[model samples]
Target: MEVMEIIKDAFVFPSKDMKTLLIYVLLSLVAAGFSFFGTVVYVLGFVNPECFMWGGMAVIISLLIGWVMYGYLISVIKSGIEQSDEVPGFEWWENFITGFNNFIVTIVYFVIPAFITVIVGYMTNVYGNAMIVAQEIYLQATYSYMGSSSAIAFDAIYQALVNLLFSLTITITVAVVVFVIFSFLQTMAEARLANTGSLSEALNVFEAAKDIRRIGIGKVIILVLLVIIIVAVIEMIFSALFSIIPILSILSIIIAPYLAFFAQRAVGLLYSDIA
Candidate 1:
């Protein structure tokens, strides 16, 4: 299938089974809503330490919902890839297991990148904090020699900022590359798992990488970029329209699943063609 055809089908395919799609939407809404709530709780906790307990509970519940939803969506995408006639609906135990497995795949795939990011972040924090303390001490010690030490203080601050920015840039760059690579692998793996019902196959990095090459890495990258652009545009439009009416923003919970499914279906269709 051509990329355009895949994209077109993504938008049109769900209508063929609107009832099932709606059911998926409802489930998606619950998952997304809770996830959003959890994030809000976390932010609140960050702003006010007293909310930490509530935030922790919310985050845990949200993670559970998000995982189940992720698995269910993969099931939906798999159905699309196989050109199955029936749309998938809620299968609680099945979805949870699949979701958990998918989560594991993601964590395992990104562990190295995540570890690097954490280490870099921690180092940046420590270095930045040390710089602040040193600057303070420098100012205290040089109170009588302020004129001579001003340059030293300025240089110290500039170096600290430069180091922080450089570390952040490297961290972000590495993260983005890792994310794109794993995203390609995961898409193929999920589609395969969905098609073959084998967790082992889904987790097979070598096989997934081979499929990515077969599918044409360039094409996959292009398709992913296109999907991201389309989704971003849709989100911007949705946000603009919905922001005017606070209550209407709730509709995104329902709409987001459809958009997500559409993207997944697009990739699934593309995978089906290449496979």
Candidate 2:
């Protein structure tokens, strides 16, 4: 019921507050700063191959910085909602502390999921490639013999069907796994916001994800489809606009990191209201 409430709250009215938009923009800038620095380090490392020793360090540091910024932004959003006001006079030092807390939470949430994802991806790629290669070889061998085009055609069709099924299975499997993890994180963070203390309480909130899905799966599906359509149109428009002015295109890359956080915050706000 609370999950349904959250979905309804988030979906009924979708306009973003100007203040929240500004917060997202600011956060985007912060994230981009770290990303740019990381990119520079990456390029420099490759240019000077001996600089590879520091490459991992740079990546680790970049991830830490980015994580902290994201956490801080989320904390600020939570705080803002609690205070019933916009991030009460934006103190950078305070944000740093909040960000660090968020960064830690993020790593805890992601470690297992990332490992699982890598394993699944590796297995899927290996299997998928092997299937395709086997099919290709079979087709070649059949082609070289007895002029039996019909048999070869049937074999090709069978292989295609098998490959498609395998691909679909792998894709759907991964998607479901990742989405579940994401839903768990969303529920936890939003609950923590709702009950203003207890990280453990936040973790407990994820137990309700099944109920949330049960009640709101249709709505969630619709919302996802709508978002995809809207984003597609927006992307097309932006793409055309960028074609006219190349500089504007660069801004999209800069805003990319904030997009995920902003979307998450928006969804959380909607769900929290429902809860």
Each prediction's TM-score versus the true structure: 0.75, 0.56
At residue 130, candidate 2 shows an lDDT of: 59
Candidates in order: C-alpha RMSD to true structure: 4.7, 6.4
Q: By TM-score, how accurate is candidate 1? A: 0.75
User: Which lDDT tens digits does candidate 2 get at residues 27-64?
Assistant: 55655565666567667877886555465565566565
Tens digits of per-residue lDDT for model 1 on 181-211? 7777877888877777778988888998998
Model 1 has an lDDT value of 0.76
lDDT for residue 182 in candidate 2, whole number 0-100: 67
Alpha carbon lDDT at 218, candidate 1: 83
The regions of model 2 sitting more than 4 angstroms off are 1-50, 79-83, 88-198, 208-235, 250-265
**Pairs in clash, predicted candidate 1:** none
Candidate that would win on TM-score = 1
The list of candidate 1 runs beyond 4 A from truth reads 29-65, 118-148, 244-250
